[model samples]
Target: MAESTDPNPAAPVPGLPERILLGAAYYTEYQPYERLEADLDLMAAGGFGVIRVGESVWSTWEPRDGVFDLDWLQPVLDGAHARGIAVVVGTPTYAVPPWLRKTYPETTAHSATGVEIPYGMRQDVDYSHPTFRYLAERVVRKIVGRYADHPAVIGWQVDNEPGHKIFYNPQVFAGFVEHLKDTYGTVDELNRRWGLTYWSHRIADWSELWTPDGNSTPSYDLAWRRYQATLGHDLIRWQTDLVRSLVPADQFVTTCIALGQQGQDITVIGEPLDVAGANLYYATQDGLELPGAQGLEGGLASFFVPWSGPAYLSLQADTARGTRQAPFLVTETNATSIGGTADNFPAYDGQWRQTAWHMVARGARLLNYWHWHTLHYGAETYWGGILGHSLEPGRTYAELSRVANELTAATDALAGLEPVSDVGVLVGAESRWAMECMGPLAGPAHSWMGDPGSYDRILAAFYRGLFDAGLAADIVSPGQLADVGPGLPDDAAAAALVARWRVLVVPGLYIADDATLDLLRRYAEAGGHLVLTPRTGYADADAVVRSTVAPGVLRGAAGVHYLEYTNLVHPVPVTGAGWTGAGTAWADGLLVDDAEVLAGYDHPHLGQFAAVTTRVAGAGRVTTVGTVPDRELAGHLARYLARTSLPVDPWRDARPETVTVTAAVNAAGERLRFVHNWSWEPATYRLPAAVRDVLDDVALAAGELLALGPWDVRVLRETP
Candidate 1:
């Protein structure tokens, strides 16, 4: 529970080795042929340090009720240990066995009241259901109890990527009512806080509450989402606690989060975990190019890809680091092409090494691919792995093998590296859930329909801006803002928080409590630059629109007020002092009070209102962005903020169009720089300081030109 931006960095986890652990999820059970020995030899030869097994096949683990087949994985574990490759045993709870589903039909999750989701897919059961919970616990104990003492087992993956479903079962809804009753103490309090009197939605009794299936009320939807997230949190916490009791303290317990999954708050779910873990998958090939693709066109699907590819990938990495504000494990990433048959865009040549180094530079302690080999027949048959359908090593295997060897060579300098960032981006699950319920922005093709990804788009835009401007950032949640972890005095804690992060960017924070908003205002007043984007502080914690002026409590600090806003059907030209870019999707009609207008609209009708403004508040500054700025505009804003608020970056001289650089401090307090040429064309950058290449053990003087080939990356440590 340490403060995310603590000046004193967290020490490395006790049990982990002092190196970047690299491997893949090995599913020996799924292989068509018995080649366990061959695979283990290949992994050892490839410099793999670990392998994850037994997370997916519940049917294989427990083929029938009250029957367990636990010995099948002994050979895989024994072979892995013999080769010095560590093993992370996973509890097969995410996917239910056919026997359990067939015998307990009522445990099947309901998408709507009385409408059961069929059992063809995984995570189709209501985990909160007592019957399902009992069976899941039984199986978890059976699996962990069997392998906890194995010499090869170094950790436990509690469950594979949870939070896929929001259960609407009778028991789940009933528990929600009980949860509401406990939280509110009475029905009247719920009615008052939720403003249930509007539209005759007030209920005299708890029984009168409507199910979430068709609840159009924003408050109800937010509460439902929050409660559902708790169910997932409780399940993970429960599983982790159960696993801890069975396994030794050295065997870490963690659940890999599929970030942005439905009905789960990653920050909350990660609290009980020993170390944060996440599955990061990104578009490869041309999608990995820098200064490349155009910005998202406001489509929900397109939100996954941003104007800057590195920015999008870094965003996910930053998010994973944010969960614990420390080094995290990459539980799963693309070994080859990810997704369906039509999406066979694997990494191009050295793109794999570039990405692996990128993850390491962003504070990843371990990296594991989704799988070892591609399955011959399954729903994800086309989801390629290191080895192809032919089960032969190819380009991906060679590329990853080289990466693993490099990681092994650079282990001493790269291990337990804490990424350095001067900027912090605030992200909250409530705001995201509230935005999803409200759908304030429109889709690219249809302005009439609401875009469910409005919050993601806004958050990504600001983060992309920082990345495009060569500024490293930490993605933080509102909860981490005030948590000045154990043993810090109040005065020192406040100073540590402000001194650690010079600037904070909060975008689309539509749902914020008074404390969170007040903390943000105080941060600005305490000599930190506070950047507020559109839809921030527009509503209360309950998703109710504030009666005060937009931005509510922070309006005084921001020195800006807006009583009206509009959703633009097309992009509108925006002009500032020395920059020109377009605002897309939504715009706020800002009526500035005392703030200096930084930008304005070019359209005739919207020309009277300011597009961006800033003001000095106490010892710091507050900047307000009234619309979603395009990549160019956002980058300009980020550069301005960085120049005024952050120390001059050492790698600022590098060309950002092709070459990008990020820095992290290792446990030994040595700064490590990861430089990548994210382009098809070869590039070179001058060393800002004398450095030694950790991987190659080569030294270079300050101002020496470093040549990099296509899709290349270099890890350097600063030298005197």
Candidate 2:
């Protein structure tokens, strides 16, 4: 067997490869025959440089409890190494072996209803259980000891996407109580913060506290969510530390964090890993083109695309990149329909390439398909891979090879390129948690609150607005903005991260701590622009309503105050400064203090209140939006803000349907442009100068009209 030479146990945490990494998840244990050598031939032909293995087969690794059987994986790793392919070994802890499951039944987690989840599928195990941890350590030590010196191994993916489920086990519940005790110290403090006096629910002892089941207090639910998020983070850190103790520093560790997985705090989960990764699957076309997508004529919906796949994908990819503040790896994506279903559409001719290149443009250094071949038998048997179940080279395989070759050609040009933008979208885990506790989105009782999807809809609307304005934006998390305190953080790096952005967008962040607001106030005072929407700063970090007026702690900087708001039963007409639109969902009845009214409601009773207002704070400015703006208003504000504060404007025009452009510079200061037509119809754009496409080497001149077919994307390199 080949052995690792000198990777240097102490290196400054190696980053992604210099060239783009083309890879896929390989399963040698799942093969029907002995085809390790033959599979390597296909991998080489497709230009794959890496294969992820050993993550899915825990039962195969240990046939019986404590009986290690790694004989099957050795040949696969060695064969891939012989063919010049690297390997990323998975911890295999995601799926528990039947023997271990039966021996220590407590390892399995229970749902909110207190029923223990059966062990048929994966991610049913309670990560907090001591039995699971003890056995996991044994298996991990054995695997790492054997493969730590393997030549082909480059990294380890820790327990495939922790936080897919929440553990309602007794251990977790006791841990929750301990966490609350550490935070509050006494029962009176907990009672006060959670407003237990209401409905005579006051508690005298800590034992009275229970899980947030059924209709528990909102504050209790918020704390439970936060605690669960921490649980996920701790599991990742524990596994990462275990791996590092045995392997060299160069052998990186990561887990594929899934977005919209409510139980996990992504920022904390990604903090301990060497690099960040995400599994991004786009929404199918059928889901987007449904009725009401196009909206009524002159309505708010008309302002956005019929389908918002481009913005959603961009948002997910940007979230991943911002997690580690560096280029990331797409650890899992699909070559075809991600699931086996008649409704699951196969990837269009050029769609997969477009999606892959989109990630590259957003600063992903590596891309890997979920699997090499479709499974012969399983729940995901129809999730079509690069190769079909027949294991024959087909159209999907040909497409993979083509994309692989193109990425190879453009590797030098795309490597180390950083996306540049003046806008930052503020997001927080606690904010999401608080919103979840706020209650159902739709009901006659809470008619002022919009539907269930209102939160995401508002965020996506503004994101799409940025696209329409031809400006790119970054999704900024609270962790990335923490001030320099007791830490060894590079002060220069911390300052530069926030300094790059000229504008900060806040979307209904109903829950925020004082420190978070303080950070925002300082960012605004330091000459940064602030954009605020309704329902922001209504509650503290504990999910308790602020005692002060709405937008508490931020009111001074925001320059607006509101005591009453209403959810729109129908769209309300709004107009200001030559722009016209309608407000949806909820609208704040605002009385501007030191701010100037930019927009006002045109309704009969609400005519006295402002719909939008702006305040000047030192060297900065804050604009408070009282409701969700129509598409026209969104585009108007985007262009107005771009021309006001930003020094470098990337787009020449704001024709929503024509094109959207993003610009970035590599470490070498070479500027690259990503131009996209995020629509289903044909579009065109005029080139600014003579430029060459990075992928196809096609060149065009300034003032030349370039045509783009439906869903087309072009990466152009500027000529010196």
Candidate 3:
């Protein structure tokens, strides 16, 4: 596959350093005692280069409405600048102040119609409300105006994680109606498109549309979700535009997006900002282990986002990069532990370094922890930070210090790094929303309710497969593919996409337009491996099921039809040419017509249908996986796909069981490789070619064995 520069250019921030920045979120106001100078000194000593401040404490920024106390943070900025550490000033908007909340009860967001979300927690206000926006603008200007010219300020984070809830406030519902009118043009058109004739739901006027509290209509739910996402986008764009007007040109603006948040889409929300920023918090310790770590079951219950060992981290990083198809900043990650009390699982020795380098390898430009010091009293009191409750540096701090030093040492090689991808996994926010509305998979304990993470579960199965098979993949968006223009008959665009991504793996693309489905077919015909999994092309963009055969428009190219599918209550054993594994959660009884059977169910009844099938369409091939494959089967499929589609590389030869190697190319036209050992047992791999160790500054010859300690990583650069 060919490598290309990032589609998005770097932000024109001249004062910002051209290197990977490392630090933590510093909240001096939250400190129990006066420790601004002490914290700055400690950060400098630990090789910290950037610190994100002032995002979480809105009440502290302004003690009351129209009463600004912006001078308090002057000392923190001055101290950071004196120590040569750059700062990212944050606008305190996500967390509303107590005074504002009490005075403007009308601004409170409703979780459901007429049911207001109780105050106390952050992000409870209806940000789209005029009152909230007016108050927010005042504090934002007060903060940014005071520190816009500070030499230490390199960037501005407009808000903390922006999308926490889907606002059900009355005004928000009114806006939703307007959004629908703008989209569909008329109530008649909406009724026809959404098939509202069912259950006598067709409305004569837009006012008859009911609230989302008890709506069972998929079309309405999908639109509501999309509108909510746009609200998040608008909020970010509004804040960014406001900040841009006040801050100097050298200061970039962004919002820290929680990728798995319900109310927003990262791909759309990051557009108005200069660069994409995300908060990546994963399960540490055994959760970072590979091979032995089973798939999504490891951390799915505790977190909203699906976590499956190293693949989870990779998926999150790839998602961030996909937001802008450029290097993104990790605004908040694990410093010690990542959750509330009873959820303490700090990294084991080298895991922090491993996680840090893995993110960098996937195109992260900055890695800032969630916090500097763990709070003594608050909602997140047990969300551990660099310093513990005792205010002393310990193992987490020391490990992160090592990570900081390594990042500093390899800054030149790591700058402007674009991760090399052999496969593209199509990720659609619309499809995700649709899947959430009418989930395909059963919830935990085989409950009657649908799993909200059904989309992620299917996506992660294939993604984890790629990770386990040691292949680098990109999480691509439908908008990115649509931007390539129509495919297939337009051979130029089709061939361009094929050249860019050798294999395109689409797992849960349940809601796609006709153009996108046709594009995938054309892509396959134009010499690209199109891997289709369950729930793909089943519904249109509006979440309406297609009347045609399942897999919709691509059925001809896929060479198979699935008129019937069942939610698997137990794992169904599957056997292929040489591998043995089982299908879990879902199974589509794929009746093949002209395709070659690659795998079949081992069950006596289900054996009548193929579990997997592939066929040639022009010069390329299309593979259809009828069920959600287990880790083993997914890995087998991934390895087979990689071998068939991607060119052979030396890194793929003699790979160790516990090791993963990801490659990238920097702007300087240098090839960089990240080799990681996820096991407690030490591992070794022979050098593929002559290379220099980026972190160690040592040279090694071809065929030399490179030894890695337990939970270790080695950054290498290929030399001619």
Candidate 4:
């Protein structure tokens, strides 16, 4: 064997450097070090320690596939190391080289409808195609082998972000069908769980199977997407395994995905890594908004966003830029939109220190600047980057060095310290896929307009509503919590908190197995609060042989008959032809036997349906909201949960909006509060009892809130 090694389980692993190591991507076709070094000096001066190298190496490595060169990589690696910055080597799974694309035409992907786009696009590869996996694996293995032992290599990012495809890929359907066949051992069995008899979707032969897409769109049933999601997750799983096969167990390995747009479940992406980090770019002007516009829930969940997994990364963002962006100024996101937007965007030049300090205060350990190098040709044409379009350093270099060195100083402490938490949100990946495949207006195969239009719309509204409510929820993997206790960041604390947060809200997740649901049911029966929204606990984790109406095995817990879910009452009536209907707020109707109706929906066409129902089951109560609720409905859910749990209010002392805050308890039982000033004017915030600033070591007055400057960061702690 290469070298038998044992990563210390007791000692904290050094994944992300302390103080949020700051650095930039440095990929300029031919830029002088003086200019590059000038920026490097600025980065070092500004307090950046980690430099993301080689995201754009494909353009140089093989102008065409089959040709390889080690000439260019050495100098850059040497340069970054010489500057004392550790490098996060990114896998080039995204953006296949033209040569590779040409040489391996088979690697190209096709949409579910069988529309094939040859060349000239990112994420165009069909995930289901064996050739695509083969080529990607080949390229990744080659890269890992060459750089696995490199001194500068500190972490591994499998792809810039995989799963950018699932929506439009033909591979999703194909792979899903194959997975169901393998997992079930037969096709007839899969049909029974999906209730395929309704849409004439029953199939006797596995070869005749279709996916969850247009031509191959498998009846928009939950089982189809459940299987497809399994496929998507399997893609990440298989790829993650490939990463570990190449790298040692100690090295942190992960994939970076866009917020809200991740095609696959993010819960799985972080499974392979020691730490799970994501790109967090919260818009400074509007709360949790991005520097530039993208989608609705901009960056609210950007930092560690509530997950039941390993430690996460807050690796991307720019606090201060040369250009005035957003609440800062021009709303300039990054210098250029090279991360993947059209060019002609605003750019910035500034020191990277303040943000570094802010991240540390906010609880980010591993810090990475958006773009290290300006992409030479295609990748750089737009998007943002640390390197100027000219491909040289400007004002952010020296600052990078300074911050990285600072992180290096506190590396051991930061790496060793575990992040604290109290609340645990259950995230079931199979459930999400089931919802996706079930179409917009999903029901138990019995509802008006049970097409894709209704299902997708309802599902989106449900998730977005949860997000808009500022619930601070996250998708968690049960595998991570298997070790379930206290003083530990993983499963231990989650299990220990059974009494603390006995109540959990699962919105639209279906395939929770008995073991997983038992955790919730037992917690609730033990006087815990449980909120089971529409379509929960129906199928097993495998999602293959579901007998219950929910995703998997937890179906029998609610003790309700598997009657036809036919009621589709809209709380608000619909008129227009647009996708949004029923006020896009309250949509589904609930059902109950001896349960109580907390809420309901009454519309013109559909009869009155129970919008909410509550019943006492063991030591707990389950309130099922059988509809996709919009942002406005969150208050109702919150109000109901509040009444049921009556637990200590986490936001009891939180004010409205002048200052937004999120609080968590560390593994040491220390409280780390992420307090963000949401206003331009300085304001005071009332601190919790006895909490003080961790760094300042100042004692906070119990009922007295402290004053903060505009956009200031404060870490509160108990008085020393």
TM-score of each prediction: 0.97, 0.90, 0.97, 0.73
Tens-digit per-residue lDDT, 1-720, candidate 2: 111111112122353466777888999778777788888999898888888899888888888998998767788888888988888888888888888779888787888747799878888889888788988888888888889888888888888878888778888999999999999999999999989998788889999875656645778888899999988888899999999898976788888788757779776788888988788766444322212132212111112222344566677788787676666778888666665444345565556666777788776777888888878887777776777888997766777777778888887887667777658888777777766556323433554333434556667667766655666777767666652222534444333433656788887777788877777776777676788887777788778888898777778987889989887767787878765767766788888888988889889988888888888876788888888776667766777667666654424463446466777776576778777665567777878767888888888887677777755678888887
Q: Residue by residue across 516-593, what tens digits does model 1's lDDT show?
A: 888788878878789999999888888988999887888899998998999988889898787678888889999998
User: In candidate 3, where is summed lDDT lowest over 10 consecutive residues?
Assistant: 3-12
- Per residue, candidate 3 scores C-alpha lDDT tens digits across 415-500 of 77889887888999998888888888998755444887899889889999988888888887988886554443477778878877
User: Which scores greater on TM-score, model 2 or model 3?
Assistant: 3
RMSD list, candidates in order: 2.3, 5.8, 1.7, 8.9
> Which segments of model 2 are wrong by more than 4 Å?
1-15, 32-34, 284-307, 340-343, 439-454, 483-498, 648-658, 679-682
Two-way lDDT contest, 3 vs 4, winner: 3
Q: What's the lDDT for residue 328 in model 2?
A: 76
Off by over 4 Å in 1: 1-8, 297-308, 445-449, 485-494
Deviation from native of the Cα of residue 440 in model 4, angstroms: 3.8
The C-alpha stretches of model 3 lying farther than 4 A from their native spots are 2-15, 299-302, 445-449, 484-489
Error of 2 at 209 (Å): 1.4
328: Cα error in model 2, Å: 1.0
Each candidate structure's count of clashing pairs: 0, 1, 0, 89
Compute the lDDT of residue 29 as modeled in candidate 1: 93
lDDT of 3 at 617: 86
